[model samples]
Target: MHKTLSVATRLAAVAAVTLLGACAGMAPAPVFSQDSLPDTVKVPAGHRVVLETVGVGEITYECRAKAGDAMAFEWAFVGPRADLNGRDGKKLGTYFGPPATWASNDGSRITGTQVAVAPAKPGSIPLQLVRANPATGNGAMTGVSFVQRVATVGGVAPALPCDAAGAGRKEVVKYQADYIFWKPA
Candidate 1:
């Protein structure tokens, strides 16, 4: 009987420790630093990151004439369609549209105007900063003030020939980028 009680107490202590460890793991995740990014893509002073998401999907480009020169055909950006995911790889939202919208799974959404952009590495999309418009539906996006797109891997316009023969053609390019959301501190 004595041996049994001792073993039972040890098991109980082990269970308690396991529970405490799990609770500790639930603490708020540490925010990522933006210091390594270019000044043009950095969030403004007094803003804090509220979320970090990786956007994975495709950007569409359409073969069209250059804005100022009809004779100069190129791939014009159509828009983007992507899944926004948390660091843990869970789908948290989506990014899409001609108007450039980001929508959270909980129904919150926002559009933004481009603030600036800096070139990323070769063959990658540019790093970008955007000023968020007022959010709709009220959730994770409610107070978002800015978004920075970084760590780009692809999503450049297609390398295929864009000429009069291919006018109006559309192509999709895969891309992955880290999108950090921020709000006033």
Candidate 2:
């Protein structure tokens, strides 16, 4: 049963990779060069974030601020886990990046891409901020301390398990993450 569960998880993460493939083109940017900006300028780079896909499930993403000016950033999916697996290790749960897809949002909505597969493969996921109609934020992706969630639209969610159900599709349960950016004074 444990072996089956592991296989299922792998399959799920693969599914997620396929899903992000559709949105691959719209992915944001990658990590900036070491000298892109001054050492004093701290931009949101790589940070683990928990995000919900509303009706889908919860997802964990390594949210990184885009190198240049962007309303969003890159995400590295980590896969998902559930409160408790059902009889067949199948249950409503969350999925994170396998290092394939990345997700992000504007403290409201979230989205991403699968640069690689298996939340911890060997690549990064793309992400962006949830922007309203006509996003009007600065192109600069600022560094931030984000809280990912499996549910809760306005709350910060935590990270999901790596070897739970649905590791392939890596579905995020719902709004359960929070991200806060510290403005430079």
The per-model lDDT (C-alpha) reads: 0.95, 0.32
For model 2 the local lDDT of residue 73 reads 44
How many pairs of residues collide in model 1? 0
TM-score of 2: 0.19
lDDT of residue 174 for candidate 1: 100
Candidate topping lDDT: 1
Q: Candidate 2 at residue 9, lDDT?
A: 92
- What would the per-residue lDDT of candidate 1 be over residues 1-185, giving only the tens digit for each residue? 35456888999999999999999889676788987988888887999989999999999999999988999999999999999999999999999987989999999999999999999999999999999999999899999999999999999999999999999999999999999999999
Candidate 1, residue 160: lDDT: 98
Which ten contiguous residues of candidate 1 have the minimum total lDDT?
1-10
